[model samples]
Target: MNKLIDGFLRFKKNVFPQKRALFRDLAGAQSPTALFITCADSRVVPDLITQSQPGDLFICRTVGNQIPPHGSAPEGGVASSIEYAVHALGVQHVIVCGHSDCGAMNAVLHPERLKDLPSTNAWLKNAAAARSVVLENYVGLVDDVLLHLLAEENIVAQIENLKTHPAVAARLARGELQLHGWFYHIHSGDITTYDAQAGRFAPLDHGSATATPPRRIYHFSAGDAA
Candidate 1:
């Protein structure tokens, strides 16, 4: 708590003053370009990672960076946040980022080991799909390797889940929005993007962009409306 208070004091005295005009402009209105979804992990700072300024990326965080399928519940904070970012804020891109050394994924891989933390056990239920996907697809890797694969697969899985939201689906269909899956390696300080064509996560080199291509716009048909 003391560390956080001191950090804020330093921010007010130095960082805030240095970016006062940018903060002032953002105070009135914000038009962020991307919706960045990731884990609720203290190590993963979206703004710092992406080098984004204030009002650049609207963020949504969950225990495992999970996005429950649309209509799974009538009302959810994650769903509402996604809808607002897409339909209201008109964010152009949605990024689902998962990181290495994810505690949520680690717990899912070894549930019995953490039987003491009932609340943690319950929260990690959200990552059940991620666990199943990894178990089915990655058969023989040892614990560490399996955990890494699960972390990467979770990012891809959640991006697909993100598209299940009505607003996100509608916008994507109209070529008005794009979705991305990314994995951040904490140890290496490297970012990798899921290549739909290659069906793998590859390093995010400047020459190898993995962003989805814009789709052709189409008029909303009866079946097309979400």
Candidate 2:
């Protein structure tokens, strides 16, 4: 508590003042270009990872970067946030990012270890598909390697889930928005983007890549609607 308080005090005394003009400009209005969704883990800082400043990215953080499919359950915060980002803010891109060593993925990978976290256990039910993908595809890998693979697979899974939202689907259909799946390697400072054509996540800088354009994800588009 004291450490958090000290951090806040330091922000107030040093950081906030230095960025006051930027904050003041952002105070009136914001027109962020992307809706970045990721885990609620302390180590994953969306802005820091993207090198973005305030007003550049609208963000939503969940336990496992899970976005429930549309119409599957009662409308929730994640749904509302996605709707607002697309329809209201007119964000061009929606990025679902997952990272290595994610506790949520760990819970799914080892449900037996989550005996005490009932709420978390319930929340992670959304990631069942992701768990199955990892188990079915990469059965033998364990520890960091297993977790890393699961993290990448989870991002791809969530991107599919994001398409289930009505507004997102409609926008995508009309070529008004784009969706992206990214896996961030926390330990190596590496980032991988899902290649729809190759059906895999490849290093962002992989030259001579045959991956589909980042704009044409899952047959969705970002141009004027028909």
Give per-residue CA lDDT, model 2, range 30-70, as digits (tens).
99999999999999999998899999999999999988887
The 0-to-1 C-alpha lDDT of every candidate, in the order given, reads: 0.86, 0.83
Pick the TM-score winner. Answer: 1
lDDT tens digits, residues 98-209, model 1?
Answer: 9999998998899996789986777676677778988998898899999998888788777777878899888888888978888998888899998877888888876554
Task: Give the best candidate by lDDT.
Answer: 1
Superposed model 2: Cα runs more than 4 Å off: 205-226
Residue pairs with colliding backbones in model 2 are 175-221, 175-222, 175-223
lDDT for model 1, on a 0 to 1 scale? 0.86
